[model samples]
Target: MAERELDPTVGALRGEDVEDRDWERVQPRRISDADWKRFEGYAAEILRAMGMPLDTPGTAKTPGRFLSALFDSTEGYEGDAKLVTAFPTECRGGPDCEISQVVEGPIPFYSLCEHHAFPFFGHAFIGYVAHEHIIGISKLTRLVRMFARRFTVQERMGSEITNALSRILQAHGVALYLEAVHLCTQMRGVRESEQTTRTTFWRGNYEATPALREEFLAIAGAHTNGHRS
Candidate 1:
């Protein structure tokens, strides 16, 4: 990954004070008055045109809440370096320390498919040959979860995951492998109902040699032979 100044926003997300709910709870996000008004204006008008009363007990605050929740779902749009930078930076530049491949979960993630606005849910495996430095294990999972909430497309998500890992670690190489079952496909009337989508990406040394790549994949627990087909 090309080096650049670390982003403060990323750090903000990783800050100690950020609520645990911010990353885990998929709740309705509070939206601005202006945005809510605009959304409700259209929603109310549409309901009125269809001769439905927007005043029902179950529906009165629905529009505002719905819009707020929708925005909240994509909250990863607010990406920052808070979590990544929170890791000690000393390990990276250490002159005499050795590099090692660190495999990170099986980090479970869920995100809306950009095209259908339906969910693509799955686990991610990340591996990086840290150049005398390594981040906390939880931070790796948090980072994957961050990108999962941010992007609409798996390809983009995969790239973002790869870039972020490589960027923050400034490693010898990084590798990410993702497998997801899209609700839109499996539950919806799609041809490949039984199939799941698989995406993988790597950067630096991991991208170069098949042997090195497979080594990392094995460490990252990429299921191959003798696994469910």
Candidate 2:
């Protein structure tokens, strides 16, 4: 990945002090207030046409709350990804340190399905071979969130995570395995339950070395299955 200045917003997201309430204040950078008003109008019209009473207890606040939640999930539209922070590698043992493949999380993420405008959500497991630099594990989770909180397909999201990790950490290899339950598939169309969409992506040494790739997959697979049950 091409080097760039670390983003402060990314750091804020990683901070323990940052709370869920803070997200309510975020506004979409691309959409204007006028545009939001227009959307609100259209949303209300749709609800009315669908025989939903705007004044009903169940449907009240749906227009505003729905759009707010949508934009909140896709906060990357407001430049969240650019805020990622990178720090120097540290080892207690000093100059001579072990280079290892770091496996991190079943970091839970939710994303909008670009095709149906629904949602697909699940855990993401990331593994990368840290060459000279090791990224903070919390930052890795934040990185996953930054990419996932947007309109995307599961396959594209996996590729984005792999590429971002490779570039951000300058890792020798990177792999991401994402398994998600897509609402587009579950709530409509075939409407199948207990079905999942899995996507895998890798680059650098992971592509060059078969063993490295297989090991990461094996470990990630175990983690995925454990979470599923």
Clashing pairs in 1: 9-80, 9-81, 10-80, 10-81, 10-82, 11-81, 11-82, 12-82, 14-83
Off by over 4 Å in 2: 1-32, 81-83, 90-99, 189-191
TM-score of each: 0.69, 0.79
Which sections of candidate 1 miss by over 4 Å? 1-31, 41-62, 86-99, 221-229
Q: Point to the candidate with the largest lDDT.
A: 2
Candidate 1 residue lDDT tens string, 1-229: 1123343223224354254324333444466778768888887777668787778997787767766666766778665345654344455444333335677677788899888878888778787776634677788877877778854788988877776666566567888888888888878768555676778898877667687677766755545322334
The C-alpha lDDT values of all candidates are 0.68, 0.72
TM-score of 1: 0.69
Clashing pairs in 2: 1-167, 7-83, 10-83
- Best candidate (score: TM-score): 2
Residue 132 of candidate 2: its Cα lDDT? 52
